[model samples]
Target: MSAELAVVYAALILQDDQIEITSDKLQTLVKAAGIEVEPVWFSLYAKALAGQDLKALLLNVGAPGAGGAAAATGASGAAASTEAAVEEAVEEKEESDDDMGFGLFD
Candidate 1:
Protein backbone atom coordinates (compact mmCIF):
# COMPACT_ATOMS: atom_id res chain seq x y z
CA MET A 1 0.00 0.00 0.00
CA SER A 2 1.43 3.35 -1.02
CA ALA A 3 1.16 6.49 1.07
CA GLU A 4 -1.56 7.49 -1.38
CA LEU A 5 -3.35 4.22 -0.61
CA ALA A 6 -3.09 4.43 3.17
CA VAL A 7 -5.83 6.94 3.93
CA VAL A 8 -8.01 6.19 0.94
CA TYR A 9 -10.72 3.58 1.48
CA ALA A 10 -11.16 0.93 -1.14
CA ALA A 11 -14.02 -1.52 -1.67
CA LEU A 12 -14.17 -4.25 -4.23
CA ILE A 13 -17.12 -6.06 -5.76
CA LEU A 14 -15.61 -9.38 -6.67
CA GLN A 15 -17.17 -12.09 -8.77
CA ASP A 16 -14.62 -14.77 -9.31
CA ASP A 17 -11.06 -13.42 -9.37
CA GLN A 18 -12.22 -10.34 -11.27
CA ILE A 19 -12.95 -7.19 -9.28
CA GLU A 20 -14.60 -3.83 -9.78
CA ILE A 21 -13.68 -1.29 -7.12
CA THR A 22 -16.17 1.45 -6.38
CA SER A 23 -15.53 5.02 -7.46
CA ASP A 24 -14.74 6.07 -3.91
CA LYS A 25 -11.96 3.53 -3.81
CA LEU A 26 -10.66 5.25 -6.89
CA GLN A 27 -10.54 8.66 -5.19
CA THR A 28 -9.30 7.22 -1.94
CA LEU A 29 -6.52 5.58 -3.90
CA VAL A 30 -5.94 8.81 -5.78
CA LYS A 31 -5.46 10.68 -2.54
CA ALA A 32 -2.45 9.84 -0.44
CA ALA A 33 -2.70 6.92 1.93
CA GLY A 34 -3.06 7.61 5.68
CA ILE A 35 -4.93 10.81 4.92
CA GLU A 36 -8.11 11.40 6.88
CA VAL A 37 -11.22 10.86 4.83
CA GLU A 38 -13.92 13.43 4.34
CA PRO A 39 -17.69 12.85 4.09
CA VAL A 40 -17.16 12.22 0.42
CA TRP A 41 -15.99 8.73 1.29
CA PHE A 42 -19.27 7.62 2.85
CA SER A 43 -21.40 9.27 0.21
CA LEU A 44 -19.54 7.53 -2.56
CA TYR A 45 -19.41 4.28 -0.64
CA ALA A 46 -23.17 4.29 -0.33
CA LYS A 47 -23.68 5.10 -3.95
CA ALA A 48 -21.32 2.36 -5.03
CA LEU A 49 -22.85 -0.34 -2.85
CA ALA A 50 -26.42 0.74 -3.47
CA GLY A 51 -28.60 -1.90 -5.20
CA GLN A 52 -25.54 -4.12 -5.36
CA ASP A 53 -24.32 -7.01 -3.23
CA LEU A 54 -23.73 -4.58 -0.36
CA LYS A 55 -27.43 -4.08 0.38
CA ALA A 56 -27.48 -7.56 1.90
CA LEU A 57 -24.18 -7.16 3.73
CA LEU A 58 -23.31 -5.23 6.85
CA LEU A 59 -19.77 -3.98 6.40
CA ASN A 60 -17.54 -2.14 8.83
CA VAL A 61 -13.95 -1.10 8.20
CA GLY A 62 -13.22 0.13 11.72
CA ALA A 63 -10.22 -2.11 12.20
CA PRO A 64 -6.65 -0.79 12.24
CA GLY A 65 -5.59 -3.57 9.90
CA ALA A 66 -6.37 -4.44 6.31
CA GLY A 67 -9.22 -2.64 4.57
CA GLY A 68 -11.31 -5.80 4.19
CA ALA A 69 -13.82 -5.73 7.00
CA ALA A 70 -13.79 -8.89 9.05
CA ALA A 71 -17.52 -8.39 9.53
CA ALA A 72 -18.20 -8.52 5.81
CA THR A 73 -16.49 -11.89 5.64
CA GLY A 74 -18.27 -13.76 8.37
CA ALA A 75 -20.78 -16.42 7.38
CA SER A 76 -21.29 -14.78 4.01
CA GLY A 77 -17.74 -15.57 3.05
CA ALA A 78 -18.62 -19.22 3.52
CA ALA A 79 -19.95 -19.19 0.00
CA ALA A 80 -16.41 -18.77 -1.24
CA SER A 81 -15.49 -22.07 0.31
CA THR A 82 -17.93 -23.65 -2.09
CA GLU A 83 -16.02 -22.10 -4.95
CA ALA A 84 -12.97 -24.07 -3.98
CA ALA A 85 -15.02 -27.23 -3.66
CA VAL A 86 -16.46 -26.66 -7.10
CA GLU A 87 -13.00 -26.23 -8.56
CA GLU A 88 -11.92 -29.46 -6.99
CA ALA A 89 -14.89 -31.27 -8.45
CA VAL A 90 -14.13 -29.88 -11.88
CA GLU A 91 -10.55 -31.03 -11.67
CA GLU A 92 -11.67 -34.46 -10.60
CA LYS A 93 -14.01 -34.67 -13.56
CA GLU A 94 -11.20 -33.59 -15.86
CA GLU A 95 -8.99 -36.34 -14.48
CA SER A 96 -11.70 -38.90 -14.95
CA ASP A 97 -12.17 -37.73 -18.49
CA ASP A 98 -8.49 -38.07 -19.17
CA ASP A 99 -8.41 -41.61 -17.75
CA MET A 100 -11.34 -42.57 -19.95
CA GLY A 101 -9.61 -41.24 -23.09
CA PHE A 102 -12.52 -38.86 -23.58
CA GLY A 103 -10.23 -36.10 -24.77
CA LEU A 104 -8.69 -38.21 -27.53
CA PHE A 105 -9.71 -36.82 -30.92
CA ASP A 106 -11.29 -39.28 -33.32
Candidate 2:
Protein backbone atom coordinates (compact mmCIF):
# COMPACT_ATOMS: atom_id res chain seq x y z
CA MET A 1 0.00 0.00 0.00
CA SER A 2 1.04 3.56 -0.49
CA ALA A 3 2.43 5.44 2.50
CA GLU A 4 -0.62 7.65 2.80
CA LEU A 5 -2.99 4.69 2.61
CA ALA A 6 -1.01 2.84 5.23
CA VAL A 7 -1.26 5.75 7.58
CA VAL A 8 -4.99 6.04 7.00
CA TYR A 9 -5.40 2.35 7.65
CA ALA A 10 -3.54 2.71 10.89
CA ALA A 11 -5.82 5.53 11.92
CA LEU A 12 -8.85 3.43 11.05
CA ILE A 13 -7.54 0.60 13.14
CA LEU A 14 -7.05 2.93 16.07
CA GLN A 15 -10.59 4.25 15.65
CA ASP A 16 -12.03 0.75 15.42
CA ASP A 17 -10.26 -0.35 18.57
CA GLN A 18 -11.42 2.71 20.51
CA ILE A 19 -7.86 3.88 20.95
CA GLU A 20 -6.85 7.48 20.75
CA ILE A 21 -5.38 8.31 17.37
CA THR A 22 -2.08 9.82 18.34
CA SER A 23 1.13 10.37 16.42
CA ASP A 24 2.86 7.73 18.54
CA LYS A 25 0.09 5.22 17.82
CA LEU A 26 0.23 5.98 14.12
CA GLN A 27 4.01 5.54 14.08
CA THR A 28 3.74 2.25 15.94
CA LEU A 29 1.12 0.90 13.54
CA VAL A 30 3.04 2.02 10.48
CA LYS A 31 6.23 0.49 11.77
CA ALA A 32 4.38 -2.75 12.50
CA ALA A 33 3.23 -2.69 8.88
CA GLY A 34 6.91 -2.61 7.88
CA ILE A 35 6.75 0.85 6.34
CA GLU A 36 8.95 3.80 7.14
CA VAL A 37 7.11 7.09 7.26
CA GLU A 38 8.40 10.47 8.25
CA PRO A 39 7.69 11.39 11.86
CA VAL A 40 6.67 14.87 10.76
CA TRP A 41 3.69 13.46 8.84
CA PHE A 42 2.36 11.69 11.94
CA SER A 43 2.92 14.79 14.03
CA LEU A 44 1.09 16.89 11.47
CA TYR A 45 -1.89 14.55 11.39
CA ALA A 46 -2.13 14.43 15.16
CA LYS A 47 -1.84 18.19 15.41
CA ALA A 48 -4.49 18.74 12.80
CA LEU A 49 -6.95 16.55 14.70
CA ALA A 50 -5.92 17.52 18.21
CA GLY A 51 -8.72 19.93 19.06
CA GLN A 52 -11.40 18.19 17.04
CA ASP A 53 -13.79 15.38 17.93
CA LEU A 54 -12.72 12.41 15.89
CA LYS A 55 -15.94 10.42 16.36
CA ALA A 56 -18.06 13.29 15.10
CA LEU A 57 -15.72 13.93 12.22
CA LEU A 58 -15.70 10.28 11.28
CA LEU A 59 -19.49 10.07 11.58
CA ASN A 60 -19.92 13.07 9.32
CA VAL A 61 -17.63 11.48 6.79
CA GLY A 62 -18.87 7.89 6.93
CA ALA A 63 -22.59 8.52 7.23
CA PRO A 64 -24.72 7.85 4.14
CA GLY A 65 -26.19 10.90 2.42
CA ALA A 66 -23.51 12.78 4.27
CA GLY A 67 -23.93 16.10 2.53
CA GLY A 68 -27.57 16.29 3.59
CA ALA A 69 -27.85 14.29 6.80
CA ALA A 70 -24.65 15.45 8.37
CA ALA A 71 -25.40 19.04 7.55
CA ALA A 72 -28.90 18.74 8.93
CA THR A 73 -27.66 17.31 12.21
CA GLY A 74 -24.79 19.74 12.68
CA ALA A 75 -25.95 23.09 11.36
CA SER A 76 -29.13 24.02 9.56
CA GLY A 77 -27.51 27.22 8.34
CA ALA A 78 -24.70 25.27 6.80
CA ALA A 79 -27.16 23.01 5.07
CA ALA A 80 -28.87 25.98 3.50
CA SER A 81 -25.51 27.39 2.47
CA THR A 82 -24.52 24.09 0.91
CA GLU A 83 -27.80 23.98 -1.01
CA ALA A 84 -27.19 27.47 -2.29
CA ALA A 85 -23.69 26.55 -3.37
CA VAL A 86 -24.92 23.51 -5.28
CA GLU A 87 -27.57 25.60 -7.01
CA GLU A 88 -24.99 28.21 -7.92
CA ALA A 89 -22.68 25.60 -9.36
CA VAL A 90 -25.49 24.14 -11.44
CA GLU A 91 -26.39 27.59 -12.70
CA GLU A 92 -22.79 28.30 -13.66
CA LYS A 93 -22.57 25.05 -15.62
CA GLU A 94 -25.80 25.85 -17.44
CA GLU A 95 -24.54 29.30 -18.31
CA SER A 96 -21.31 27.85 -19.64
CA ASP A 97 -23.26 25.42 -21.82
CA ASP A 98 -25.26 28.33 -23.27
CA ASP A 99 -22.02 30.20 -23.95
CA MET A 100 -21.11 27.43 -26.41
CA GLY A 101 -23.53 29.22 -28.77
CA PHE A 102 -25.47 26.19 -29.98
CA GLY A 103 -28.49 24.23 -28.88
CA LEU A 104 -29.07 20.50 -29.29
CA PHE A 105 -32.40 21.16 -31.05
CA ASP A 106 -30.84 23.58 -33.52
lDDT of 2 by residue, 38-106 (tens): 788788777776666666787677554656655566677667777998999999888887899865565
Query: Model 2, stretches more than 4 Å misplaced?
Result: 62-100
Q: Give the poorly placed runs of model 1, Cα more than 4 Å off.
A: 1-73, 104-106
Q: Which candidate tops TM-score?
A: 2
Whole-model lDDT, candidate 1? Answer: 0.52
Candidate that would win on lDDT: 2
Query: Measured by TM-score, how close is model 1 to the native structure?
Result: 0.27
lDDT of 2: 0.79
Residue pairs with colliding backbones in model 2 are none
Question: Candidate 1: minimum summed lDDT over ten consecutive residues — where?
Answer: 7-16
lDDT of 1 by residue, 3-78 (tens): 2233233444231223454555445454534455565654566465655554234453334234455446665564
